[model samples]
Target: MRRRKLSPEERDLWSRVAATTQAIHPVRPAPPDDLPAPQSTPKQKPPPPKPDLRDFRIGQSAPGFVLRQDLAPPLSERLAAGPVRMDRKAHQKMTRGRLEPEGRIDLHGMTLAQAHPELIRFILNAQSAGKRLVLVITGKGKRGLDEGPIPQRQGALRHQVPHWLHLPPLAAAVLQVTPAHQKHGGSGAYYVYMRRNR
Candidate 1:
């Protein structure tokens, strides 16, 4: 059926009537005060005043809240800055010679020139292969039997290895450099703990 267009006055009146029309609440008989609540699902308790601790998801029946990772401190600041000491358990185990190294590199005969580069390469390779604990054997130098014209120092690599590990290139990968446990070579070697590769 064709509809007729309304005059301006009729349109204004109709708009006013529509604007005045309020949504009406549906009416239903209330349940008796003693009637049990619906059993299809349990009522949810209101969430605690504070948000839950972790970001874990809850069961389908319940809702979960995501903790704000964006509001957290930046990674550089959050991390313990320079070098992370081995966690207590690992430190204890390592100090006691219980935790064995995943890999080891011996600089028994390499010169200072050779040892530095080799040390860097060894650490990088270990980190790439996902080895966290490793041994770096820098053998203790032999003592001179006779007093030479020039006095020589013993354990050059032993002293230098610690310094090299602290340098920038290897420093980022190396977590800690410590004296090797007795079973690993004692004073002649070092235990290098590497950070997880990102």
Candidate 2:
């Protein structure tokens, strides 16, 4: 259907009527009393104050202490009378050949490439020779490949010895392991105790 456009006078009159309606109906706000009151939150309790003490003594000596006298040999004498039993198996393993001068072998300056095959042969030969204790110096891999490309993640043999000991030929011969003495190579070496091949 065709619609006819409003003339200029009619358009002007419609716009004035719309403006009058908007001015009269400007949004009426809610009364102030209808809005929420400010909340009154309770105050939190403060932490308790630190205690004050005039006299507090730790490790205080007791007055008039009577000592019980020993009727047997002194503690040191008693301990020395019997062989000292090591509580740790590892300590015992490390000292298995403490009295034997020829029981240990140091492999400190050798690399994994050199030591791996030699270690297998060494264990078999030592076992065959009836040697129970052997010292291996894998050195603490702390100084591993510092200046080379593809730097070693482990301290050379420091970390590799234990894993190598667990391999087929070596694992079959080894009975126990423990950290070596400072004179023997300290943390860089280990005392590998082997079981006698029957």
Candidate 3:
């Protein structure tokens, strides 16, 4: 194959530019054959020091393993930890089952769609009728077949009711909502204290 020859001006420009540049990777010298060949095996870090197992028994936990704890507190603890929005003394009595609920609504066996509007209507009517406290019974949810990747929490309604009570429509009429006392249904129901209708 014939090579294209550079013009005189082009050849001059190439020589000038090439003179200013340094080789990024200069050619390396060949190693002597008499010396041992360089090992191809890459240097590896020492395996993480084996955990001390001298005293470990067959069933004992491995050293440095921590007993896992739940990241979030239980639902009851979270509710009790919230700041008091109602009168302190009355709040105390209400939680202790001393204040009786004037009206009760059992919302068990209903889907979320079926239960929400009913709850709103019940709370609104109770407030207008001069009720002070009411019971919202969202039975402790059943353990259904958990077929999804994420683990499901028991009591869908139980967890959702409190969140619903805090939203605008119900939040206006509701003064406080707490898990019910044992006689009133324990964690299965809630004591919903109503604000004055006016």
What clash count goes with each model? 0, 1, 1
Q: Cα RMSD (Å) between model 2 and the true structure?
A: 19.1
Return whichever of 1 and 2 wins on lDDT: 1
Q: Estimate each model's TM-score.
A: 0.54, 0.48, 0.65
Root-mean-square deviation per candidate: 22.1, 19.1, 11.4
Which one is best on TM-score? 3
User: Model 2 residue 168 lDDT?
Assistant: 88
Residues 77-154, model 3: lDDT tens digits: 878888888899999999999999999999999999999999999999999999999999999989766555566678
Q: Pick the candidate with the highest lDDT.
A: 3
lDDT of 2 by residue, 57-137 (tens): 788753443334335553224323544333455455345434332355556778779888877887788889888777777
Stretches of candidate 1 exceeding 4 Å from the true structure:
1-84, 144-152
**Candidate 1 residues 1-198, lDDT tens each?**
999999999999999999988769857777888997666877899976996675656563434432322354432233324454779788768867898899999998888999998988889999999999999999887754434444445667876888788888998998877777788998788888899999
The segments of candidate 3 whose C-alpha lies over 4 angstroms from its true place after superposition are 1-70
- Model 3 deviation from native, Cα RMSD in Å: 11.4
**Pairs of residues at least 3 apart in sequence or in different chains that clash in candidate 2:** 141-155
User: Using alpha carbons, what is the TM-score of model 3?
Assistant: 0.65
Q: Which has the better lDDT: candidate 1, or candidate 3?
A: 3
